[model samples]
Target: TMDIRKNKIREAVQTFENLEHRMEPVATVRGVDFVNDSKATNVNSTWYALESMTKPTILVLGGVDKGNDYSLIKDLVEEKVKAIVCMGTDNSKIHEAFDGVVKLVDTANAQDAVQASFSLASPGDVVLLSPACASFDLFKNYEDRGKQFKDAVKSL
Candidate 1:
């Protein structure tokens, strides 16, 4: 009985799917993958998302700054990111942090961010929405942000 239970647990773990707002693959439109990682509301979480990328990435970053230290993910961004789309009202800090590191585009909403990211991406690239700050600036919460990102991807 114990052996059977252990095997069942292992099977469940093996079959587990990614959480909704954490590295969730929203869609693959025109060979460009759109990923929503809105639960990543801090620099460290965003770093993990970037570290897992195997393809060139257009990262959608920004939100209500939570005293985030962009330096924590600077090296990973330099290595993995081809461009950054800032989806927030004020993106001066994001631009300052990534100055000369990569191309940066500022957007005010989810749809614009997705469009900008898609335009910047080529086939086989990824557009990752892993905002490294809180969502209160433009969204009610992280879940709302993730949903908006998914909706934007569906429109593409």
Candidate 2:
């Protein structure tokens, strides 16, 4: 039993690939990588996504805010994110929370958010969709949001 478990663990580690919607790589356009982390519906998950980023990031954030405390990611945002694209109905909270921390812009949908994030990204930078809120405002679920983000990145 111990040997079987060890073998399974080794095989899984060698073949493991993370799920499509959580920290999934969508595409590389003009040297900038696009990533979908639409499963980040909470501050802690977004923190993990932001923490794993190795390059400057243009973050696509915003959805139906579940009273999210934007302060949770404030230091990480300041350290890693170059810009932010808000893709929610009301962006006032995001603006207020991130004002002076990083550049912020409001976008209507996934496509526009991707375009805006791309424009802000330079070569070696990344565009990441790690919305830290509920997807009910703009998508059927986190999977839908991630799919839309991937489609938009592919179109670019």
Candidate 3:
């Protein structure tokens, strides 16, 4: 089993999003829904982010697929994602899995990915960069990936 305390905290955070669904929609705030889930090399983290969203979402997904099974987040993508912008050189699998389920775009670098995501997202929508794979594909590590995402978001 994993760390109980950490699991509890995650459960608590997810529960809050679940609860937020009940809140009535008021005014929509226009901002990029930037997410830095570059540590999700196993696919589960991407699934968590997708499941947690209550707003229109643009998913920025890419990186080295480590035996990834994209089907795991398929339904979540169809339900919450407004579009899918990839940030990797090789995106054959990501495209094959979600080509029709959502609009698909690709980027060779972080800047393009962020810009494309911003374009796909609108007010009250989220531009989520939850790469469900390894960061070594384009970045030195997960921290680098996260920092790039934050910088791009701040620039927007």
Alpha carbon lDDT at 154, candidate 3 = 68
> How high is the CA lDDT of each candidate model?
0.93, 0.91, 0.77
What would the per-residue lDDT of candidate 3 be over residues 1-156, giving only the tens digit for each residue? 569989999999878544321211212226544656666666787898788889888888889888899999999998998899999879999998998899999898888888888877777787777888788989998768777776766676
- Model 1 bad stretches (over 4 Å): 1-16
Candidate 1 least-lDDT 10 residues: 11-20
Looking at model 1, residue 66 earns an lDDT score of 87
Q: What is the lDDT of candidate 3?
A: 0.77
User: What is the clash tally of candidate 1?
Assistant: 0
Q: Estimate each model's TM-score.
A: 0.92, 0.92, 0.80
Clashing pairs in 1: none
Every candidate's CA RMSD: 1.9, 1.9, 7.0
Candidate maximizing lDDT = 1
Residue 39 Cα positional deviation in candidate 1, in Å, after optimal superposition: 0.3
Q: On a 0 to 100 scale, what is the lDDT of residue 17 in model 3?
A: 46
**Which ranges of candidate 2 are over 4 A from the true structure?**
1-7, 10-16
In model 2, state the lDDT of residue 114: 93
